[model samples]
Target: MKNMKKLIIYISFSLMAVVLFSGCKKSDFSENYYNPEKAVTADVPSLYAGLFKNETILPRYWNLYTFQVPVLGTYTQIAGYTNGSGVYEQPNNYTGDRWNDFYKNVMARYREIEKHYNALTSADDKEGYKLFLETAQVFVYDQATQIVDMWGDIPFSTAGGLNAEGKIILPGYDNGESLYNTALTELKRISDYLATVTPNNFYLSQLKSTDYVNSGDLLKWRKYTNSVLLRLAMRISYKDEAKAKSIVQGLLANPTQYPLAEDVLDKITIQPNSPTSSLAPADQKEIWNGFDVIPYPGAKMVNEIMVPTNDPRLPVYFTTNKNGVYNGVANTLTEAQVAEGATNFIFSRWDSTTFTYNHLLPGILVTPAEVNLLKAEAFERWGGGSAKDAYEKGIRLSIAFWYGINNISDRVEDKVEPPTEAAIMAYLAKPLVAYGTDNLNKIATQKWINFTIMQAQIAWSEIRRTKLPVLSFPNDPTSVAAPNPPTRLLYPSAERTLNTANYNAVKDKDNTTTKLFWDVR
Candidate 1:
């Protein structure tokens, strides 16, 4: 009887053990179970949006456009230029609020990506995020380069990098040369990565839009990247022509790469409407909240030089005021004129100006028109391709794009005589208007005109390089308080407070008048 009882106990114990093991095995393979498989993926699309289109970027751009006291704000205030030249100071100084906004806020976004990109695990899932981040980085590099050129020895690579604890801090200065080289290397890396990844393959889907270039096509991304390579190369043309030419030639040789954005699809204009956005968010109190503030001396200069002639972009770019005038304040005006509150806004319905900021303005990036004009200048200066052809194409395309009156225009048919090919050629071939020094001047002048109200920075940059579209410095006592447009901006105040050592290391090397590494002259 005892033996039989012991056998029963052993059988029961064996049955219970089998049940427990089977249950454990099933649970191990269950779908609901948590697994330590992979890390979260990062992507380009998310990174681009976060870094580039962040609210800060728009505001910085706004600051540059707004304080155009001579042109934008009716000659509101006065400031000094570098040498105290008799010419009125231009609002475009290195230490102005715009520069600080860009340096402190805009460039920081790129630094964030540089610190975090490598740590992102499941990188395969993050391709979109990565792409957008890279794109944003490119723009940051471009913006920084602009600032550095204007001021000299700027806070660059290390400007927004992390500290010992991996905490993100404000702008830290780096050598200008180092910043340029690092940015170039980063862009190259991005091009290589995008070559292998497709848009759908990325972790984020946001940046995969046809809005900027190729509708998020990875192949198109390669082209856009190559074009940017050409641009960076040209930026160093004076300092390093051989290297610049090499990059330019490489891009030109690679037909598979993007030659340039050729259509509206290729254009990167932002739609003006958003749920919460106003025509003039800066002027919340005004009735013409979204209307364009009319011509300042800046626009007047442009119109006087290019309007009612070969350039058709003027009418499309700016609408006339109610009394049938589009006037630019003379540069000699006092700050009070600029500060006047009741003046009708530039492009408002009340003023019969159809081109209000809310209604017609488009956010601009690189475009075929600008690229064509750039090539014309390059050819004219460097020698090789047909400068005249490139110039003509640039003018026509610029007008077409500006007017929304292209072959693809939903409203216009081929019925209108586009600037006749003969007329354009004749215009380019004319002695006073074309050929010799005038040719390059006309090209730059047109580019500046086309780029109004959108990417004035590009126009300013070209002026620095070519010295075309000759500017009569603002003469208003209040506008150019010191003398002339300042060469560079003062370093932001925070640098003294947060990173004194790093700031001083590069301080003597920079000033509003200090030229950058690329501005060899």
Candidate 2:
């Protein structure tokens, strides 16, 4: 959240076999584990750093254009679109890429990192290498939660055998509820464990060089872990309110032991290194601007929700139409009616410099503003702190957070100056935005607005969970893919062929209409 802090991250991936490792060279590690295929020792630090090289986490072409825009973004009505035939449905290839990204890019690598660390023989070697596995698991659990949220059950507990152990083990789908229990339990242990582990001098330097996300900052890792735990806890609250209450209250009660990332400076994003470099990230310009397929800001997002609230982040999130008025596409229209509006270019599209055209834009995962809002909801529901105070602060921080993104706008022509504190206070005091009335509704709306299309998964998840900022989509009656909005993305067709046996076990729940466990209304 530090406005002026330099953000650095990395990416070096092989096309399946062609992978990149940035942390340590073979010479750096003592001979412990070897990958005979690579003709080198398994550099634990390098593998740990490499675990974050994923398009889904890092922001890239595949997830944004194919999966996010047509699938997740539409599911929540994050934007308004014509209820054209097949608009709601996407091909298996689009969703397949997301599944591929999670299992191959995230889960498989983390398992391999564990494989290497476990292979270290000496107690001291294992101690030295364990930090890599522990820290890398934080990244894994975060992405895994997102995957489970999207598809409900996935091949989690046993999915990564091919890459990790060099065996073709078709892993069974783990229950979504079970995944949450395991993630929360392990994440709490990691949160507590991060506080005590101090790397040795050599390993510290190795980490500093390789761990570009936080530059070996253990405090940041601790905060990220606890915040993630808080998020998952709240996500499962509806199903197990008492357990969620215990987890959330414990964090709020012991801020010292469980520090939440509640400031803009503490935001967790994949930093873009360079457009050409394969170190940290790839830019998202093409997906936002060049792609004519991305939908317009919805009537609900622009007119109903934001305009009523006088939300300051409006321009930050979208662009005005040709007439210079901020209007949005309506889902109440027929396919032809929506098409006519889109043809005229009268509705607002996503903003350019702050989003579409911003080449330097980082991939957002979690933010201080988001963390605070989550805390507000937790306190409101569970009574650990002043919900009003946290809610108001979350609004303030959200305004600041958007302005921060504005400041980093790739061009000055598109930049809008941050509103004054008075403006922020006034905006917060709006009847719709103020904290007292409709507290839960207000919190859910703010989260949806701030998240926008950039964090589409979170937006969709919250919409299903809260059913706030109430919306109605013009159902595409002729479409077979999604006659109504989908509750979840269907599993990839590849799963049916590649993991045939396991896919059959969960095939009954593969339809888009089947809700995840956490999605119980």
Candidate 3:
């Protein structure tokens, strides 16, 4: 009993000393310490690095692969492969760590960075500080909007608070509509702030080393900001046409103020230094060797779509099978059929030389193709310029992005040539591929194809919003949890146990069938 008392006293004294020392050398605490995993204060450079670190921005390729390819790809019919293990056989069974990753790892650190940025006074380099703050704000809007997009009615206003005193253990949910509106407002604020600064300014030069996304190129960051704003505005266009149109028009009216992704060079992507540095790839084997999420071109995508249209992207997007043909596997193959080798159904995987072999390849966040396509939709709905012009431009840009001038080499075995202008014109002139008077379907379909493997999540979103390029699972109705493709992912089960009351308020509505406010199909 005496020994136990002495031990307790020693621990108490140690903790007291730690507290006293921490308080006395608060400057040391502020400067030396940097841990994103915990809710501790970190320097701006460290925070910036944390934000772009593979696990933060792109995240573990497997987690994103699970969410993008297995789940969204299956739903959108971008990828198809048979798995009898029932891992991704049903919507209910489809799971992703994105919810936890976004909230805890990504958003939590973002909040900390914001808090640190806000704490800076005018005594600091005000211009440089503001630039940093604006950049952080862009991330805040991006991350928050993504959260709202994925799971409706998320805890936004009161989500990531320092729980040192345990005040905000259970943050309440904010309605998706309000959160989206808030995000738009925030983006506008960020854009306006970015406009006040120039890329060549000394303020931006300070951030060049730390800004992993754009290398402190304020202009590119601004363009990315405007592009995100355009994306968000379009996301709500179906539900809130007037507001969406107004925002879209305002941005389009002033290209100088709101620079969009006009060219492939302007596309938002992170070009990693090495495979270990980013989630690109160490070798082709790292991509093809993994069977858990091995992806093949969907049957409908290849046969009903690309083959018929003679899409030039076919060679760039996929590799030929053992039979030297670009075949595709159906998602609805039965367990018995899978066991029987599924009729030797070999399908195309992602072009290893173009993608997997290149370790320095950029991990795309948003593409110019996507922005131009969005522009096409906006113009189609509310005429600013010729919709056909935008549509053709979008298609051409997508082709150029993939095949023309990105400098990525083709597979030696495939001998695929870069798509030429004549070929692009010829492909676009096809009755099926050509832009009609009301070519929303054509535009959406092309966008879907462009997004394959590059931005599959956004492709899923486009499909959910427009229901274009109709996807069907011909066999095994039992594999699906609903008649239609799932609208939203079920909230992570951890929320129920961690934050019971708030989780209960939203849990009943949190199912695969629940459609987001923007998903008004």
Candidate achieving the largest lDDT: 2
Q: Give the lowest summed-lDDT range of ten residues in model 3.
A: 6-15
Between prediction 2 and prediction 3, which has the larger TM-score? 2
What are the C-alpha RMSDs, in order, of all predicted structures?
15.9, 6.3, 7.3
lDDT of 1 at 302: 32
Residue by residue across 1-521, what tens digits does model 3's lDDT show? Answer: 01222122211110122223233354533332244323255656567656665432442355445566667667778877563444334443235355655664456556656777777775545555667767877876776777677678887677765468834445778888898898899889888877885543655565886677888887898899999999899999989999999999999989998899767688787766555653455444443443237556677888777878888888877777778878776666765654354346466766665554444456566788888889989998899988888888888878777763224432345445777788888899888889884489888988998887556667777787888877765444445555445677776665675667887888877876888999887
TM-score computed on alpha carbons, candidate 3: 0.85
* Poorest lDDT segment (10 consecutive residues) of candidate 2: 3-12
Runs off by more than 4 Å, candidate 2: 1-42, 162-166, 273-285, 289-291
Q: Write the per-residue lDDT of candidate 2 for residues 1-521, one digit (tens) a residue.
A: 11111111111011122112234444422221132123355567767766665667555565677777667777777866666677777677777767776765577567768877877888877877777778888888888889888888988776655546653466788899998999999999999999888778777777776675677888888998999999999998898899999999999999899988887688877665554545423444554633346658778778887877778888787888888878877767777787778789888888776767666667787888789999989888878689888888888788887777767755678698888788788888889888898899888888888787778888888888878768777767788767787787788876786568888999999998898898777
For residue 385, model 3's alpha carbon misses the true position, in angstroms, by 0.4
TM-score of each: 0.71, 0.89, 0.85
CA-lDDT, candidates in order = 0.49, 0.74, 0.68
* Cα lDDT, model 3, residue 444: 91
Write the candidate numbers in order of decreasing lDDT. 2, 3, 1
Better of 1 and 2 by TM-score: 2
Q: Please provide, for model 1 over 148-178, each residue's C-alpha lDDT reduced to its tens digit, 9 standing for 90 to 100.
A: 6555566565454556995444445556666
Candidate no. 2 TM-score: 0.89
